[model samples]
Target: MGKKYNRVLLKLSGEALLGEQGHGIDADILSTYAQEIKAVQEAGVEVSVVIGGGNIFRGVKGATQGMDRVQGDYMGMLATMINSMALQDALEQIEVQTRLMSAIRMEAIAEPYIRRRAVRHLEKGRVVIFGAGTGNPYFTTDTAGSLRAIEIEADVILKGTRVDGIFDSDPEKNKEAKKFDQITGDEVLKRRLSVMDLTAFTLCRENETPIIVFNMNKKGNLKRIVVDGEPVGTTVIWD
Candidate 1:
């Protein structure tokens, strides 16, 4: 019950959106997600989300054995849009006003990346979900999260991942992996931790934005992290 921050940027892995089956968006899953986000919004936390594309495309899946990395990345960005739309729909179904902003300039389904417009939506108490991964090839959703968080001036980056927090190894795979209760971005970089891509960690560190890497499985995890500040998982800071 010692949380002191407000207005954060949440980054949800595409896999997190998949509830039980762990594939695509699930109804019970999405409904639960809507409720989690709703709880945070009700707490007066300006929330912005940057979703990943891994649930659909791994990029190299569509790439020919010798496909260009750039084109493959473009495909990955588009895949994120699909997930974004699904989230937007789910949020709206629960009567949570939300907006989809794409970095790839897809005016047909969403607004292009506009910093001012995104911040305005957050100020108006609407959740803005950023899609399409920086509108450029060779960039991961992790990078997009960093970029959007900086633009929106978020207090911290809440990274919802498969595990509770950063582990020395894959806790799911390794029987005796070590977990860190608190760590620094420099340590994450020095140790080459896989918690986030190097680009994201460096960008956030440069902007002095702390990252909270936590589990997304619990029903009220999001709200708990926002209000309780009792970190449901590990906190990555820049010392």
Candidate 2:
């Protein structure tokens, strides 16, 4: 009947946008995500999103092929902007208000990332999509998501992945991998579970921010977790 989180930061991988495609974003997946986001927003949930750029380019992968790491990371940031713009366009097409903010100054395409402005946008019920991955090299989008969530004082970080939840091992590879309904941050580190990178995980742990990992591809799953207050995924807490 009531929403679970008042405000949330949704962390999504750029590769998730590749849905059934080889190298680019799928229109169907974009449409589905837009609709899902719209549902939660309409239900009065303040949402902020940070999407990765792995679909287009990965700095580490490029570095192995002889590309300079810093240059490649900047390129990756641009790739995220591309995805962010697409999502903004899709949401606008469906009449959902959204603001695209980038860490890197891009006056033509998006507003510069301003903390107060971002929170104000959220307060006014506009979905804020944060792009460009912290504007720093060697940091993943996961870190950006965690940083923004803390800065915005979001109730939780909803990590929307392809999997249903976090597992002891890679669920796709290990048929017998165990799932935890809820887990502690220390336990996650002790078991070496790959939820987020160490830097991002540390930030969340220090801030006592909770993270919910769930299957983003599943229709109604987002609503179930955010609006219906259903236990639809694995919840990672600091305690």
Candidate 3:
């Protein structure tokens, strides 16, 4: 096997947490993720996580419904914190050391996010979950994941999605879509693929952080990528 990435930031969308349910957290899905993360940690990979809040609330959707944009965004952030807390509790149940940090000041629920402290927690083999997005309106959780990955100097971002990898088009909608084994950041931009938002994609590109888009629903995929160095997903890298 080839060398494995030492530290990685795993990005899980809020929708991922909703396994079979159309909305809300599904216990089975949460348990599966916690087990996967624990297996990866046992293999000596430092892990941190950032989860989105679209399952619970979407700021743009709220704005379309005539709600205040900023207020809706804040509510979205709070939703992420809720998801983070759920994830934290699940990981702990599996005996994985975990930390829940929030960008927003919610001292009672989570520790305020501090760059060095987060790194230290990772150093101590604790899985740090970053919640509340960027603590500011208008920035997506994808941006928060990118910012935290850069801050902690992660080797890659393991983007856990429903699909196996990034395709030329949405695989769900287009059965004929083509999948790329490996791709360049520039190509993704030129093709206008929706891997990440432009802001997060640019940040990863400029920083030379590789991103692996894989299906987390597949059991053992996480451990295979982090421990065995298996190319189980499409790797997006700087050319």
Q: lDDT at 33 for candidate 3? A: 95
CA RMSD, predictions in order? 2.1, 1.6, 1.8
Off-target runs (Cα >4 Å) in candidate 2 are: 58-64
lDDT of 2 by residue, 130-185 (tens): 99999999999999999999999999999999998999999999999999999999
Order the candidates by lDDT, highest first — what do you get? 2, 3, 1
lDDT of 2: 0.93
Higher-scoring candidate on lDDT, 2 or 3:
2
Local accuracy by lDDT, each model: 0.84, 0.93, 0.92
Clashing pairs in 1: 3-229
Highest lDDT: which candidate? 2
Task: Summarize candidate 1's per-residue lDDT along 20-137 as a digit string, tens digits.
Answer: 6646666776677778888888778888989898777743474545788888888888889998898888889888999999988878999988999999999999999999999888
Maximum-TM-score candidate: 2
